[model samples]
Target: MSFRPVKPLALRTGVRWKIAVAIAAVGALIAVTLSVVVHNAARISMLDNAREVQMERLLFAQRMYETSKPKEPRFGTKINDPALPAQLDQLMRDRRRGTFVQEHRNGGPPDVWAAVPLANGDVLSLHIPFADRSTAIMNDLDRALVIGSVSVVFGGCALGVLIGGQLSRRLRKAAAAAGRVAQGNTDVRVRDAIGGVVRDETDELARAVDALTDALNERIEAERRVTADIAHELRTPVTGLLTAAELLPPGRPTELVRDRAQAMRTLVEDVLEVARLDSASERAELQEIALGEFVERRVRALDPDVVVRVVHDSWVNTDPRRLERILGNLLANAAKHGKPPVEVTVEGRVVRVRDHGPGFPEALLKEGPSRFRTGTSDRAGQGHGLGLTIAAGQARVLGARLTFRNVASAAAPGGVGGAIAVLWLPDHAPTNTGSFPMLRLSN
Candidate 1:
């Protein structure tokens, strides 16, 4: 047979078991301690009582020897041997009628002898063995102690089970209610789950949960109404501006107007996309793609001169449209905010876009993307901040991570410091898990 190693007390025992075992153990310890102490105390008391009786008998024998003037000691039938220990004899000889005691020996029956000097200067010694009645009484005490200890332990265990079960039930109900709230049920009520009017910490927790749910519901509804109003109010004006710009005479100014109008339309579309992402309504139509080839093609489209490196050829399942948007925004940001020689590298499921520039603004890196946050003091009139924001939103929808950091300049050519953007896509889709070999597909 095999046995599992002992686990920690907390882990091995349930709440109920822990409580029961704790009470039982403490009770058992106290019971055993009291029993041992009581047993020893009773035994000592019995021995002391027996010793006192023996001394009285020896005193009586001393009186009889003095009055009758007997040559040999005269002890009652209760005493068998009438001899004093050498130490007791010396003490009685010196004191003349003083009390004396001898050590007990291990034998059939525990006995002790006492010596006393008579009035005529003759010492009288008497031996007295403990009665069978004393032994019988001690045995009865031991039996009673065992029974009482067993009763106490059982009572402690029962009380612990009752209390522990009630407490565990209340806590488990509260926990289950919290779990439902986390699962988006939002309708879970702890008070209802517990089915009690009692006021406690658990009830307070339930009330707090309800308050949080209401606040979240209100905030989400307000955001939805605001987003709808903005979309409705801006779409018409942006459309009219684009239409009006197209009517202008053919010239550089007309082209500029059209471009600005198109940019406005793009911004409006991005706002709607962001709202959808926030509401978690945007779903990805995932597809398996060769990540190295995909990243190479996207980077080359953005900048023909930019160097691209594919260290690994791995397949990832992601929405290509969202992936393209994320890559395009990153490339555009790099070109606009960073210095030349932008590099894109793909390794495993990670793609890194780095630029030899002063790096991202501290606020942008720390607080993340915000609307209209053009980086640094010199580049104040840069593009609107929606590009990185949209990129971040799209990455989230695709279940990927986008992060930015500044690196040491010594690593880059000309010893120029720069910012790096890292995007990590999931390695494989839940439905597809096939291996793809590495290939050099970047220029």
Candidate 2:
């Protein structure tokens, strides 16, 4: 590929070009204006002085003629001596002949001249020839104007350099801070002292960087606290189970020991699953599946007695493993806290799990799903409270909406309501369908 020079205009949206061009234009205009005014004034003054000199010569010639003595009369007429010719020749030589022509010898238009006889018979001529002095004065003025203009332009350019350098430096610092924030460092900050003006683009960029840094810090701190809580909750049960297994006899009641081991394994698996869903790296492996069939199969696997109702056959794209986990958690929560047999309904991409047992605690329902929060009256067993939390987390990972509420039901013994969990999946596939799902167990 051929390379082309990057235009200064293209580099910065034409701002730099505008500044430089404006400076140059102002300098050129000032220089041209001053030169024209000074040149015209000098030319007019020089011509007026030359005309005055010519008038003085004519007056002197007339005075000499009037004062000179006449020769003796011959043939009854007085003799006359005309001194105008010599005076005229002298005036022409002094004012027009040599230096005047030599000074304007650089091929400019010739100066104008006119000879007129005065009333006293003395010849007076206007010698408005170009003056060497005028030419010299104009040339000096031209030089001075050019020099002054250059000085002003260069000085202005130097000042602009100082200003633009400081501005670009501050912006670069802010850009570096933004890069650090993008790299996940929330503590990075642009030095506000580096910026001079408070209402410029640099200041706005600094403000935006600070706001983004604050938001990222808050989110990271929240995630850290959640991770600590999860670790604290899981360690206790795992330690107890490990200790009990070690204390049990090696050969007695093998079936009972197996049952206890299986329970411990299930708890560990549940904790691991929850951890995986909470991870940022973990993403769903999306695929198109029959929404109604997928929910019906998960419900049947969990409990055959549960009445599964299908109301729609719309297809949805989602990760099958994640969907299974989410549905399993909802069903498990319903069976544990609600009365059997549960009613599972599928309509479109929405799955509703309802039970005939006593409804969830009003305060807990309002507070919403939290880690380790079990229902007030659990029918199947008391939970570790991770069931609802895991379900909600997995639903979020799968880009689905999970909601819990109390629904009125006549099937309950007291005609009260039961807890209802609704999972609504999106109608489209995951954004990155080809990326593998991560099973992250660490915070």
Candidate 3:
């Protein structure tokens, strides 16, 4: 009844976020560097211009004193009586200077002070306060640089996010296509399905996945053909052998021959069925059936001693024949390979069969059911390993999922982990629109 929430593709982390952050960082560095260079150059140019204007006024004031000989002469348009600082006046009086310019605080405010001697030996001095015109120009430049740098940083970050989203969406699409292919849906051709117009690395990756899935589909098809042919070819001979064994006299040798012949026939049939399932040739006949009663009947028919527990009562639409085959194989596997007290629990749409055995092999859990991976544990040359393979195949055809895991056996003294085979079926018939959740990993 409950399903885990699937995680969505992320733009805040992984390759997307990394790419965005890297690009933004480089842009921000460039912006800061340019702002610093431009700010310094503008400050130097403004201050230099201010110093030149101050010097021109000082020269004009000296000319005014020589021509008019006024008591107090206004130097230039912006200059009042050019007052000399004490240091510059002393330098002029000592005759230790010609036309000169210097920058100092000089007990007042920071300014650029210039002194020029008059024809009448009067030293007219000029001072440009550092905080007046030049400081205002520098402050305006500072604000503009700050704003420009911030704009560049924000613009770069936004562009990075946009580009990151585009790239991440492409990659996520390809990844999702590959996931479906891995889950046995080999029809996924990523390049053809979601390939972009402009070719890039993402397109290259999608093409690679397309090639891989195509190759796998061809190989699987070839294998399926071989399996089906061999199974069909063996069916007749195996039937003849069985008939011949039955014609023989009643004895141990005759019984052994008949039993082996029957097993070979069953193996051939299972192989053919698997081939059919692989080729998508099998179809399910769905009907609403009582879940509790149907499972109890199947469990009793297979092994009366096996325990059956019905936790929920519900009707499900599924093929009864295929369902029986799946349940039968699971019960047979537990009987042959697992310890005693096999238990079947039907909860919701899931039927779990637990056996008190040494559990499934690690390889089996990692790699689902394979062809002939039967291990020699308790019995020598007992199981052919096709039971789970066939069960899993049938489960797939029925729009169900079959999973096997190992469960703890704490109550059983001296007992180890036990094997648990789970068969999950959809509650209703699959729609033509899309697929239902087929499988879930057991916790």
Which candidate tops TM-score?
3
Colliding residue pairs in candidate 3 = none
Candidate 1 clashing pairs?
Answer: none
Runs of candidate 2 exceeding 4 Å displacement: 1-257, 377-380, 409-415, 432-443
Best by lDDT, which number?
A: 3
Alpha carbon deviation, residue 33, candidate 2 (Å): 59
TM-score of each: 0.55, 0.44, 0.80
lDDT of 3 at 336: 84
List model 1 lDDT by residue over 124-199, tens digit each.
Answer: 6666666789878988999999999999999999988987777677778878887876644556776688666667
Score each candidate by Cα lDDT. 0.77, 0.66, 0.78
Error (Å) of candidate 3 at residue 288 is 2.4
Give candidate 3 misplaced runs (Cα > 4 Å): 1-12, 61-110, 113-126, 195-198, 375-381, 409-416, 430-443
User: Per-prediction RMSD in angstroms?
Assistant: 11.3, 17.5, 7.6
Candidate 2 lDDT tens digits, 1-443: 99997867544443344555566667667767877787778766766666566556544544554565751222111122232234445654454321122124587744533344434443343334465776677678778877887777776666655656666667677777777666444556765534565467778768876986787677866775576567557667766766677777777675577577666656666666665654444677778899888878877887788899999878887889888887788787777778777898999988888886776676567777766667555433666788887888778777778887776767755556777888888765344542434436787
What lDDT would candidate 2 get against the real structure? 0.66
The order of the candidates by lDDT, greatest first, is 3, 1, 2
